[model samples]
Target: MTIKEFKLPDVGEGVAEGELVSWLVAPGDRVEEDQPVAEVETDKALVEVPSSYDGVVEELFAEEGQMVPVGDVIISFRVDEEGDGGGGATATDAEPADAQPDSPASDGSEPEPDAGEAGDDGADAEPDTPSGRTFAPPSARRLARELGVDVAAVDGSGPGGRVTEADVRAHAEGDAGSADADAADAPEPRPAPTPTDTGSDGRKSAVSKRDAGGSAASSATAAGGPEPAGRETTLATPATRKVARDRGVDLDDVPTDETRDGEAFVTADHVRAYADAVESAAEPTPEPGPTDDAPEPAPAGGAPETATASEATTASGDETVPYRGVRRTIGKQMERSKFTAPHVTHHDTAEVDSLVDAREDLKPTAEAEGVKLTYMPFVMKAIVAGLKRHPYLNSELREDDEEIVLKGDYNLGIAVATDAGLMVPVVESVDEKGLFELAEEVNDLAARARERKLKPAEMKGGTFTITNFGAIGGEYATPIINYPETAILGLGAIEERPVVRDGEVVPAPTLPLSLSIDHRVVDGAIAAEFANTVMEHLENPLLLLNE
Candidate 1:
């Protein structure tokens, strides 16, 4: 038997690292080749990492939630050397056996805490002696720095006594509160304090009072801003940090509701939200008019009404939700596309009376064949025709190469809104497929996407995209360009509207279309021409049969 170490493969193009979401196979489990051993979440998608050799699982080197770089040893297996010839079950990019693994485990159990990872309740060492190094996730450390809490003094409640963000917050508001109160009181003597305002009040006010005593407090302090160099402890992506520097905004001052591992994580949206809030607050407020609604006055005797549970929860503070995984990935992609490409949307209405009639006629035929037909297949056909006419619209701009690469194949991405976020599953070779074929594939892909069962490959390699906002009852929307792709088509609800025909106004069924193009690569004239070609096909449904 030979022991083989398997390195984490590069699951996506240009991906540098991935988060270990979970382990599908554990130690001592026998697995076959191509069997998924672990699930990893990359910036692109969530993918299952498969095993290369059939063998018994020996060890797992990474813990869940840990970010692992590509080419790092992740697992080990023991296989018969003679059964697989001289291949020996070693991964192509496997590291040396002597190389140190990340959070390596001897058995199917959590790794022991090292000096650097030591938490509270140091049973391994003397109680009086300091561990010297406080162990925590990056987020917890960032929170400690932000709240001015001494993490070493915080009693950890996490596994192995690791300090968490909650621990830091509690320590700052509870344990360190007396010290803060003493410091605040040292500046000025206070008269006899009320019993109601002694313990909890002093502790709770510790965080708020620091802000109140600081310059401009929250927004004003932020408006004045700090140096362009943001705080070292602030957690944000490289792109977000760059945006902060470009906007001359202090990242530390920009508030966020998202946290990672007990640290406040800032996104570009958070930065923009803060800026918008500041701008809105700075605007002048108009005097209330007689018709304006005002809050009801308190009852007599200067007393207020008792609040309900829901109201009390609302009054406490805004809830903090972690922004990560698929939603965060979607946000980053949208942001990149919006900022990188100059977009121009051309809106028009198509008289689809014939198209509607044609679909109705074919409905029975489709139903008999066990196929559910939708307007999307017809629209997809029309879009393919339009792309064939205007090849520039079916292309991508390679900025580094300074070239416009026109795609030969027509693969369309259908944007399906899932509970996690908006996911676009690609339907390959749309031009080659018939209406029935397209309809079946679209329905299957959409269903799987909503359930999050679609593989990573099904979500990539789209030449163009079609989003049906009409399904949700929208008439028109300036849809953002799907990055890399030169254009995207948004469909609006089809309804009967008054139209002019033969010099007479009559009601006709019309479909609203909004085509957004990358202005940098596609010209306005070309975009309009493409849209017109699409409408021409829809106006005459027979033309689509020829497709």
Candidate 2:
């Protein structure tokens, strides 16, 4: 069998990297050529990456939420050199450096005794695997690390005895129960330690718990302390240390079962279990009635003590979410566009009584052909006409080359708001397509964009962009230009308003327009002229037909 590595392919024109959102196929699963193996999120859109070889998946190199550069290997496949390559892959002379040979259960074959199971004299021998690592997927392993459980000690309940997330959680809970039982069987607890410091104000500060040491008796004594201090010497992974700090648990107070280099090895699970037990033991018992033992209530008008930062932090429940993927991509793009170019926005209103009538007349015809027609198609047609008259508005600024390239073809990007983030899917050759055709393409692109089914290429190569904030009942927004493109048009809700025509006041439908341009490329005067041209087409539908 030949092991072939699959690198992340370039999904768009200028995409240099992508985030591996998820894997569609797992290791050992059979896949055919051109079958989708993973979903990758590029700057433009989310795309499904397909496999290149017909084989069984061997291993995954990139984890979900990790950014992978183009041409970097993300996965590997094991292919049979001779035969149809339809069945599960068998063992070969060559093996991946990071992966071990599959066992009989993984290959769907009969089990056989391992060389380490017995010696020539029929005595037990050493194990085949020296690393002592357990079998589990990346997600399961991540869960184990988060829960501070040693996955190697957990019993796997999946195929080939693979440890799953549920298994890890179960093992952690069981370990916690065992710890509790052992604590219950210990001797009676000792008295609380004396306060070691007194302030000028006569307030007594409790001794720090971190110096209490690592014995079970010490842990029980320190559980009632006010503050936990850092340990003098604690051996733990960085992740475990972080978990301990987050839970306000001191490493010195947490008991451990394993040791490395003659030092107590602590895991996140140990810290968590210790924290839970301490919390349970620290619950205050309710007093049924007032007694001399209960402290006197604070004086009626006495001043209250100010809370410390740590106390306030614990009182307020705060949460943290990871900032990555599509949201981060949009933020970077917007920042670059805002800082790289000086933007100018021009606001205006157009009386689109004719445009409204034109769309209403064509709605029935569009519906007969199964197309959902909206005002966007008319606006797109009018925008294209305006671009033809003012070429600079539909151009790109090539700063490195110090030149402005006027695009002859009109490819307009439509800004779509999706649950993931804001995505712009470009409609190619807008000038050549008719009203119905434009509406159909726009609807299809918007639908796919929301469903995250759009390909990267479908969002690229736009000379101009249009955002209809009106669909959300917004008006006159100063939109940022899609970088490299010189301009973007924002459309607002079309509503009936008072207008004076032929020296008379009357109610007429008006459309609000806000056009933003890169001041480096198009002058203010030129931008105003382009806006005028677009408004003219909207006011007189015949002008659009003439185009």
Candidate 3:
């Protein structure tokens, strides 16, 4: 058998690295080329990483929750010339060396997920993972943390005992408080898995370069006595502490499962494992009854009645969110855009009564064809026309070569704000598509973007960007240009306001527009002209037919 290493490919443009969210395939699993083996979270979205080779999993190079740099070997596969790599629904689901998949039934296979047929997967399914590690999606784990439920403690009813989002929600709603509380109050140092010799992410492992700890017996104290008073409570690395804090766990309450230098030692892995146990074992919390005479319960850390939340935050009582994924990526991009491009915003409003009437007239016709008509299609069509007229608005400046690049393709990126962050799913060749086609594509892409299903290529190769801030209720504000793109058009709320159309102050629907441009590429006059052209197309939808 020849071992071949599979490195993490760049999932998104300029994405330096990604967090290994979860391993869809375990060691010893048979996998095919292009089969999804891992879920990697890049700055843009949660992407399913496909394997580049057909082989049996040899060794997993990185663990979940680790931020691996791009081009780092994530997993190794053993490709035997004579070996059958045809992936079948394995009886074992390719369990790792020491870990076993959870069994919903006495039989060691996963429960059937037939939605129509109810099986023993709901209440009876419990996490029977004997190994310390648990296998669940990163999103499921995050939901568990927010619900204060432990994912490892929940019985997974999913395929191969995989915990699903529904499992976490069910765990949070039902059986939320259980024996897990005692374990959470008494977390311990976790035995570290064997460290990989791959590139480092600059995080510390709880297990130092020495003997570590692990065992079922280590989780609890001896039944005969209380924990030894003289024994140390917790000793951990800084990275472990930071990881624990990020997981909303307190290290002081965590039990020291392993002793180092006559003291209990803990690692970042331990804190995470303990958190899993805590949330999984959690049962439904009972609602509190009111005490009329009693004062309201104080939140975490003591705060004065007069102090504002900002004051309390300054008083060392705030949760620190590690900026590494999409948020971090957005920060870097925004910084580069702000500093590199001298941004000048032009705000304007157009009384779009005719446009509104045209959309209203087309609504029924579109609905009859089973399509929903939104203002976005009109806005996109207008923008494409404007781009053609003022090419500078849809271009990029190459400083290194001191040249401007005007793209022939009209790949319009629509900025969709999701829970993950701002994701721009591009609509390629917008000029070639009609209003209905554009509307369908825009809706589909936006839907998929929020669900984190948009492929890496769907977000790339954009000439200009559009951000519809009006959907969230704002009118006329400066918008940042997506880097490498010369301009971004922000649409504000469309509402009826008194307008002087033909010198008459009658009620008319007005649409607010904010055009932000890279001053280096487009001056104020060019931006204003582009905005006017867009408004003209919008006001007279018949004019769009001329394009």
Candidate 4:
């Protein structure tokens, strides 16, 4: 049999190590090429490692929860003599210099058997001796000994009648322990209960002895029976329950009304009603003091003593939610970006009245071409035009070498907000695509991103980013720079406002722009100049078409 070793692949984003979360295939199982063999959790994300060759799993090298360095063998496989080109070979047959006995083969197979197992001769060996036991894998035997059990006494339960640790533990508790313990301390076996036949009985059922009572005791307790009292009960939803936990309110302590049907449940409305009643009942009133006992006078030019309330008020209308998945990922990324990037934001408002006219003029032609026109296309086109003039903004800084690497092509990243999180998909070579084409590409990318269908490569390698928060009604925001990029631009709500045109007040379309740039690569002057150039294109939209 040929054995092949499978080393851990370097999951991109420069990960050095990954934790083995789970193994989908165990030793002695058959696996196919390109089949996922194990799931690994890296610092960036969780990825599954697929088998490179088709073979029988001979051994698993890494245990679940173990952290494996990149390039380390994680599994091994044994293949047929024809070899299947999957690199299946036994460790004993052609052992690698760094091959550990438990290391995974590149072909996802098991290692060669140990010398003792290979040399053992078939015979009717002693039941108490370890050699007499059916072959147990190293891990199984180790676990058996750790649990203080004899493998030979255990029944074989695994494949090929292998004695597993579970079998050893079961036998030890069931039979072996009983024989080893002192006779007086042994557990007493219980006697089976006697059964009575209940056939064709037309008489009343008999009651248990514990339930029988005399009339005198019933009469006495009847006079002292517990009394029922009226009390208010509250209801709450799952979301409210979570909020109560965060606010230190005990749900059990909160009175709840019993339901007549199905399960007893609480509603959010009931909880709110109880909270309101408590607040109304606890309202405070002002008190008047004696006229002679006047309050102390304030000193000249001194501030008055403020009455600080010690207790905090409970939240009334707000709901609490746990951070998870993509939202959690976004939170971590924002935290890192905000702290790592020394952000310096510069804001400016630009008049886009002419740009609006220009878009209106192109709307008919764009419709004829079966494409929807939007302000984003104009913004992106302007940004790309400006980036070409100010190339520093379209670049990343390498901190390790303290050098700035300017990019030749413009991979514009359009920031899209989805239910999952904020995703940025690159629009490659924006300088080459016209306004209508760029708009279509942006629309396609945004739709795919929201659907979570954007490939890893599509979301990577962005040289600059634009976040149009105006779509959601934000006036202006200092957007965080999508790092390694040096800069990110924020487009605010475009509204028609009165402007001075030829010394006369006239309504004009205005757009608010906020530029956040990395000070490490571009200075304030350069960033401002780039923003100004972008504004110039937006003001004179004809320039975009000419370029």
- Clashes per model (N, Cα, C within 3 A): 2, 2, 16, 30
Point out the worst 10-residue segment of candidate 4 by lDDT.
Answer: 191-200
lDDT of each residue in 1-547, candidate 2, tens digit only? 4567788988764677888886665444445678777888765567778899865565566556668899987776765564423222233222221122121121222132345433343222112322233467656655654554555567888987887999988987787665543222321111111112101122221212333543433444565633332444445554465566556677766777555333455667888877766654454445666665776453212313333544666678755467777777667777888899899999999998888889899999999999999988888989999999999999988888999999988999999988777788999998888989999999999999998778777888999999999989976999999888999999999999899999999999999999999999999999999999999999998887866
List model 1 lDDT by residue over 1-547, tens digit each.
Answer: 3566788988653456777776655443445677777777665466678899865455556655557899987777755454443322242112222111111222222133355323243322211203433446545654654554545567788987787988988986785446544222221111111112112212221011112222222444355532122323344543455455444455666766554323455667766665555444433344579635765444222223444544666788866466766556556777888899999999999999999999999999999999999999999999998999999999999999999999999999998877656768899998889999999999999998776577767877889999999999988999987888989999999999999999999999999999999999889999999999999999998899777
Ranking by lDDT: 2, 3, 1, 4
TM-score-wise, the better of 1 and 2 is 2
RMSD, one per candidate, in order: 17.7, 13.7, 12.5, 22.2
Q: How accurate is candidate 1 locally (lDDT)?
A: 0.66
C-alpha RMSD in Å of predicted model 1 compared with the true structure: 17.7
Give the local distance difference test score of model 2. Answer: 0.69
For all predicted structures, in order, the TM-scores are 0.56, 0.63, 0.64, 0.49
Ranking of models by TM-score = 3, 2, 1, 4
22-67 in candidate 3: lDDT tens per residue? 6766443445677777888765577788898865555566656678
Say which prediction, candidate 2 or candidate 3, comes out ahead on lDDT. 2
Higher-lDDT candidate of 1 and 3: 3
The C-alpha stretches of model 1 lying farther than 4 A from their native spots are 7-17, 42-45, 68-73, 83-315, 502-506
Top TM-score prediction, candidate number: 3
lDDT of each: 0.66, 0.69, 0.68, 0.60
Clashes of 1: 2
Q: Supply candidate 3's per-residue lDDT for 77.
A: 66
